[model samples]
Target: MSDGDPADDIMTATYRALCTHGYADLTMQDIADESSKSKAALHYHYDSKHDLLCAFLEYLYDRFVERTSDPAGADPAAQLRSLVQTVLDKPEDDREAFETAVLEIRAQAPYEPGFRERLTRFDDYLAGEFERLLEAGIDDGVVDPAVDPADTATFLVTMLTGAATERVTAGRSVECTRRMLAEYVESHLLTDATEAQL
Candidate 1:
């Protein structure tokens, strides 16, 4: 690698390669080309394409956590909106390709234990975060006390996953889903007083 950390360089390359070729058609050579490293170097770090992609999934999850784990707003309602927006936001240039690649990987999760395990971690972590936010909102008198945090968290996570998948598979716009989620928050989750503030 260049003077920097090789692993970081490789992960960046993997992301680029995935965007360009997508998971179904991706190869180690594609990653090597993006990284400017030899195929042997790629293999030195990963035994096979499957292994490399498994590691890449973990890396992607870590980056997702880093980007989203911080609370961006003072109020729980604002934080919920921020979190959902972050999930739906994508860079304009590679949005389609990158989302397609991720969808391909998610599709493979059904048959691939490694992928299933990694992807499950994403769902579990996101659900936990959602639950935490809902509980906080209730405690602060912003969310409806009748809302069950666990159930609501699961519903929100499922909604998000559906939005992501529909965007790639059906060429659906996520903005509609985003609006629906916002409406759901305003009507279903937030207290009447909290809704007025929003």
Candidate 2:
């Protein structure tokens, strides 16, 4: 664990710097300076900017998993809402960093096998999680039985991505996304019978 600490610290520092500086302006020296670690030390762990970025993505996913798994007692819809809200409500500085990193990695993913794999894994995991939640919602009668789990999951994930993109690019706040999603659930997922019960 002690050995892992520095690497974690480096990843955290790198993420913060990326969020603040964005990908175009980000540099190894910036990471080193922000992290307060020697350039040699940073190099000792990651050989290149790409490697560090890949690690950063991994770190973010790990955090995402932990956050999702920690809370219990809520139904699937509530859990999903919580997940979206968590992402939406992330500290602005951190959100900017994450967006910058993802955009940078996405741009280079075509040429980098490892980065592409990491990106694919992240997307797959998110989609899978949504599928599970949709299934649960169906079982609980909270979601429409006729809704295709895979298709609905894909749609919800797409909506989330669009909302996040808007938040990042158009200066839109998450409240807009939240309102839209709530309306979407009420209109599409919850049946008239269920609506009457609520």
Best by TM-score: 1
Residue ranges of candidate 2 with Cα displaced over 4 Å: 1-4, 70-73, 91-98, 192-198
Candidate 1: tens digits of C-alpha lDDT, residues 26-130: 999999999968999999989999999999899888878976796588888788878888887764444688889988999999999999999999999999998
Residue 126, candidate 2: alpha-carbon lDDT: 73
Q: Give the candidate number with the greatest lDDT.
A: 1
Q: What shift in Å separates residue 34 of candidate 2 from its native position after superposition? A: 1.6
TM-score of 1: 0.91
**What is the C-alpha lDDT profile of model 2 across 2-84, one tens digit per residue?**
13587777987887778778877788888888786988888898998878888887887787676655334357666656655
Clashing pairs in 1: none
lDDT at 164, model 2: 71
